[model samples]
Target: MNAPVATSLLHPEFVQRPVPEALVQALATRFGSQCSTALAVREQHGRDEGAIAAPPPSAVVFAESTQDVQDAVRLCAQHGVPVIAYGAGSSLEGHLLAVEGGISIDVSRMNRILSVNTEDLTVTVQPGITRKQLNDAIKDTGFFFPIDPGADASIGGMTSTRASGTNAVRYGTMRENVLSLEVVTANGEVIRTGNRAKKSAAGYDLTRLMVGSEGTLGIFTEITVRLYPLPEAVSAAVCSFPSIEAAVHTVIQTIQVGVPIARVELIDVNSVRMVNAYSKLSLREEPMLLMEFHGSPTGVKEQAEMVQEIAGEFGGNAFEWAERPEDRTRLFTARHNAYFAAVSSRPGCRCITTDACVPISRLADALLDCVTEADASGIPYFLVGHVGDGNFHFGYLINPDSEDERTRAEQLNQQLVQRAIALGGTCTGEHGVGIHKQGFLREEAGDGAVQMMRAIKQALDPQNILNPGKIFTLQ
Candidate 1:
């Protein structure tokens, strides 16, 4: 296997190659109008939500079907050019950046809900279908996909990142929900990972491998994910806390005692203010916990009452419930827009978002320390988290044009990640280790573990043509 590429995340070095005339001509000939070399198109596919600079791909292939992806990958592999998969452009870790100029396979057009087996509580979809779109399609069936990553990100991207959001506390993350995947490997071979059976003593667990592979191992053409029956009674509530510590402790205690909370999100005072202004909601600007419960009416009531008592122990105020569907939508939409709300709070500023997760017992310690450090840094910031699962983020707002600010943001992120690792937590909770967390991943997983991962990459992608310069580099 190739030795681990010695590179710096701050100034990553990629093997950039010009898109060969022959390869471009071949792709254009095959895809016809679906292919593009326009600067505008290349620019869009070159970056994601992260604050990273990388060169745009030489060309883009708007793949409409699995065959299209296979055709594109096969030709790119033959030419020994990198292939970066593009989904919703919502990844926070720079997963979609075309650091090595080549062909970008835009799968957004491949979006099609192939099948919905309501009886089996599962759905198979093309890589391009967004989570919200999938839910809308299956809403009438009394079942829905629950992995919401704030962004209306494509299911394929979520699968790629192994994402989990508010609903993860109850419904689990993409790793748990995904049952099978249809992946196009680096060498242009198509393979299916698993079957529809809920449980299996499957060999190798390739589905799990590809779920969070970030398109390095393969390009996902079709994905079959588990769905859940919509809760008969749904309710949302917001509870204000006297302090961030109090709010966190309440969450810790609620989880320890088992409240069966569907979603429990924490919004620090700063985030509340930003969201209030952005979403035009009149909410108390304090450390607050936004929660949702799903169950039968009586069961939901019991869960809420149990959680209320737990929160009261930590100085939580009265629970303000959103009973109407519209009210609940407005509340959650504001929560989901936390990142945008934070950015809007400081115009001309970008955020270095941190996704640090810890053990439930250490949640309060990890979160409080990270928040305190960010506060002391004097960088304008907002904090939000799926704290129910001991996961949280601090969106440190920084001026992209200011070198000093960028350095400070990166320092803060590094410190937070190290602290999480010290506390038996991951540098990233849901956001995969794209270019952003490559260094931290090495620190957390150790050299041996990372070596095994690199070995797998080398074995599967000897040419290194699949999303090169991500996760870890091999040379």
Candidate 2:
């Protein structure tokens, strides 16, 4: 492993690459009004939900179709300009930043459901379709996509980040659900990585390679993913615990006992209080487990009983069930709004979030230590997690101008990641290694693995024009 280095949450020195005037004029002529150089548009495309600040892209290309993406990419490739793919702009890491100076290919206009193979439980969609949009389109088909990454993120962005949210413990993540992809390479050559087949002994496994590449190797145009039929019966419940340890331990036991939970999330006291104030709901102010079970009525009941018993042993409060669809929706909406609620709690603050996932057996140990440290540091923060999968996040709210706050938050984040790694886990579980987690990525993946990644990046994008200065820096 490379020697550990101090990681900073504050903005790093960004080296801007030149976008020649000739290239700008050519893009305008080719794309007509579809291309934008307006400061507002560029600014919107330049940054994401991540706290890091960087210069906006030189231009933003609003791609409406695969052909549009291809044309834009081809033009940028010819000019040797960096190309950054933009989806819903919901990235929590700096995945959407144009740190190296480039033109952003905005795929949000490409939202469309090309085909739905209900018989085969698969759907092919344009890259810009958001998870909520896709689910709304297929609601009546008796099927739904389960990879909910909290935000209504675009399918392409979700796939690129390998996102998983509350439902991931049971339904798996984008990495497991994505069946195929149509991608535009660095040179603007289009290629199909796989078919709709559920299982393939195909060579190379390129589909997996591109799924979480964070737009480094290629730009995704179309994606085909697995779908599941809606559960015949669904039940949601919440149970508060005396402490985070109790909540997390209950989850560990529940998972180890082989309960097929549909969704399980941990919300610390800080998040619960924020959600109550922001969402106008009266949830108990305690570390809690928000859980769901899906199956036949009898099966769902059995699973809930088992989980509730497990919780009882951990000193958890009685389960508050949300049996009605509306009630369940309201409950989860609050859960999904946790980040926004936390942000709103502290006005004029930016969040430096940490995504660390550990082995199930180490969940309590990994989480408690971080929680204690955060409390001791007196940093305002909120904690939430998909503990059934042993993945959680700490969003430290800090004043942007305060260098001390940023340093402290980054220190907490660095320690959290190191603990996760020491426990046989990853620095990032769902979020990709955007600029924020690059240092931790090196610590986790080691020098040899990162070098291999660099080799792949060079082989695929030799000019280093695709989302350059992300994941890892070129030596």
Candidate 3:
């Protein structure tokens, strides 16, 4: 097949079309076989962990260094080509999709941990290093990065999406942990957005802007993030509730009472069934909440006791707490695999997974409403959530070829997003609005804010070549 097109690429056209063969020739000059004819195949370099409108780019640029990222951006700009930044491709909102058909600058090759500042409790790394790899490198030092999104996602991809997970309740999100970044602007200029200091009264928060920009703003080559000293003592628990609403409510009360939960995830009845059937874990056939606490033995003990008491008040049962390393490992591992189990529950169907976040107070109500409506609508869906942060996912399984099922799924999605917005939450918690949630962004951001964002996009990549048809429309 041929390369894809880029319409208003810096050079002003899609890559697949019959333009000058300049891009291919130039890519061959810089990064030989790393470039691809089918960006779809290269787009496969990194893809959404779950299904969600992922379109491959025209070609893949396997970059080896920060200079490689800079060189490719320059060549693409000179040729008017759209560039889609890619990492582990574990995003959910289809952030790595090159809908405008340009270059998928696959950065996984730049995998290196430059230096570890154990003194400052910070680590500097190339964007390509996965969380697992980074943690493996630093585990010996008793310093670990805590913003986990379940998958072994790349630091760059995680940073771009502002990813957070179970540890968010206690360790905070990418927003709180990222210390600095080396970004490549739309014009191929390399710049540093932040610093090593804990806090800064800088001119503007560009670091925060790039954290969740999801690659639409610029490409990150180097990432500097704050690290945490591993907790001295850790405890894990799996608490069951009569219903998801009850489990969710217990999570709220636990967080409200300042129980210091490291992780508290909601697994609805359907999710429990799927995980059991897939992983053969004979968990109770009811809504479940898997939680963990980090602190000294005395502190964790106190926290777990307080949480159990609060959960008991809300009709939560089976509050099984585990102290041994193996026991805690098994508990969280099972919880992390819940998504894959949900998808594999039904054979031969892909998962269109999406998550939304609301204010902690409104979390229980919104979740109850969405789950009930989805079940009543007879849609094939599963529910999971990091209820500690009021963020949850609805994984829908349907054949894309079947218009009827897709339509019903879309309607359910619209309803869920509307309800989340009504409850003071975002349409997407961390997945982002790549292309799937662009419309919802308007509803969430209002026309005025969207207009300003569009203007910013115009100013940065005027040709709309960076990543077309994402977050906003160009034409």
Candidate 4:
């Protein structure tokens, strides 16, 4: 097959080829002020929230239109130079890093909502538009995009990563939300994958193929996403549990009984402490579940009561309510900022984030074991989860300068992924398999599947010029 692309979780070795001088001149001549070889811009384009420290791209190009993206890709393809798509720069798995060094196409300026079809429950927007921007654009329409990664991330970036968040328990992830895409292929040709229609027995699901490709297959220029009508009633509550296992069991039982919880998140005791400190709140320093229910008022109350009873059986107590809109926003915003809270809890500490998803039956086993291992390691860490879906993240805190700490964290991550796989789970549930999870992806997908992916990559971009050295190394 592809001959075992990566043998380690560390950054892949990339050959740095200088950007062609002729290509640079041509791009500058065409885009003038939109092209930049400045160190500041290149540095900004190079790094993300990932642990890998790859070299920056040789240059950065601001693309304001699909034609702009096509022109840039055409020039880069002509020179056989890599082109990394840049969105909100919030990818956690080194998806945006310019590892092979070529050009970064920043499409943030193309932020425009092209159209909203409330009748069809779909909206078409440029890749540069952020999720919050899209929501704000359609706020008065009584419909909202349900896929939220909580980073104010660009829709393009979210689509590439196939991201999901707390609401994923009910609404589903990007894989379910994205209906179609206008993609600029590696050869600079534009192709539409599907349409705004809800469902069809279509040929191949190209929309899905491009959804989580992380810009390796093609660059998305325009996207159509499914939308949901605003819920008639929404209620949020938080309950603290005596133990992590108890909190997890509560989630499992609630899901098993079919509460249809709109959002159900798990916060470990350590994370709750850090979050309380960082967000300036007085919350119980114990394992907690933050839940939301949506439907008619009676339906919301029924779901909440069922969950409360289930939580009580698992030692959950003192459920607090965030019934007001502002309160709910504050609560969720704090949960979304759990990464920041964990990092700030230890100044100058870098985070090695883990996204492990296991079967609901094995969620407790997986999470409890992980927490026990982290506790045994005596490393500072924080945890948060969308446990209703059996997906969670652990932010392993490490001093940036300490290779020893990094090694320990990587070991713990490996152990967790192995455990999840053994339990019929996945290495990543929401976060895309960027550079970080390349090894685990192979282990999870097998050599045959990986080779199939590599074959597709070669067919689409023979030069390996689009986000090279990501997802897998095409050696």
Instruction: Give Cα distance to truth, residue 273, candidate 3, Å.
Output: 1.0
Superposed on all Cα atoms, the candidates' RMSDs to the truth, in angstroms, are 1.5, 2.3, 3.9, 1.6
lDDT by residue for model 3 (1-475), tens: 2343332211323333222477878887778777666634664753666555434565788888888899989988887787888888778766776666678788998889998999999999999999999999999999899988898889998898889987888888988899899999888999998899988997998899788887888999999999889999988888888988788878888888778889988888898898888777788989999888888999999999999998898898887878899988776777788778877877777677778999999998888888888888776789988889999989888775666666677778888899999888999988777767887899999999999987887788776677666676754
lDDT of 3 at 288: 92
List TM-scores for all candidates, in order: 0.98, 0.98, 0.94, 0.98
> Which ten residues in a row are the worst by lDDT in model 3?
6-15
* Residue-by-residue lDDT tens digits, candidate 1, 1-475: 3234333435556557667999999999999999999999999999888877788899999999889999999999998888999999999888888777789999999889999898888899999999998898889899989998899999999999999999999999999999999999998899999988889995899999998999999999999999898999999999999998999999988898878999999999999999999999989989999999999999999999999998898999968999899999999999999899999999999878879899988988887887888888889988899999999988889998887888888888999899999999999999889888898999999999999998999899998889887898774
lDDT of 4 at 385: 92
Candidates 3 and 4: which is better by TM-score? 4
The sequence of per-residue lDDT tens digits that candidate 4 reaches over residues 280-382 is: 9888999999999999999999999999999999889989989899989988999999999988999988899989899999999998899999999878998
Local error of candidate 1 at 175, Å?
Answer: 0.5
Q: Could you tell which candidate, 3 or 4, scores higher by lDDT?
A: 4
Clashing pairs in 1: none
- Sorted by lDDT, highest first, which candidate order results? 2, 4, 1, 3
lDDT per residue, candidate 2, 92-187, as tens digits? Answer: 888989888999999999999999999999999999999999999999999999998899999999999999998999999999999999999999
lDDT of 4 at 122: 94
Error of 3 at 97 (Å): 1.0
Candidates' lDDT values, in order?
Answer: 0.90, 0.92, 0.82, 0.90
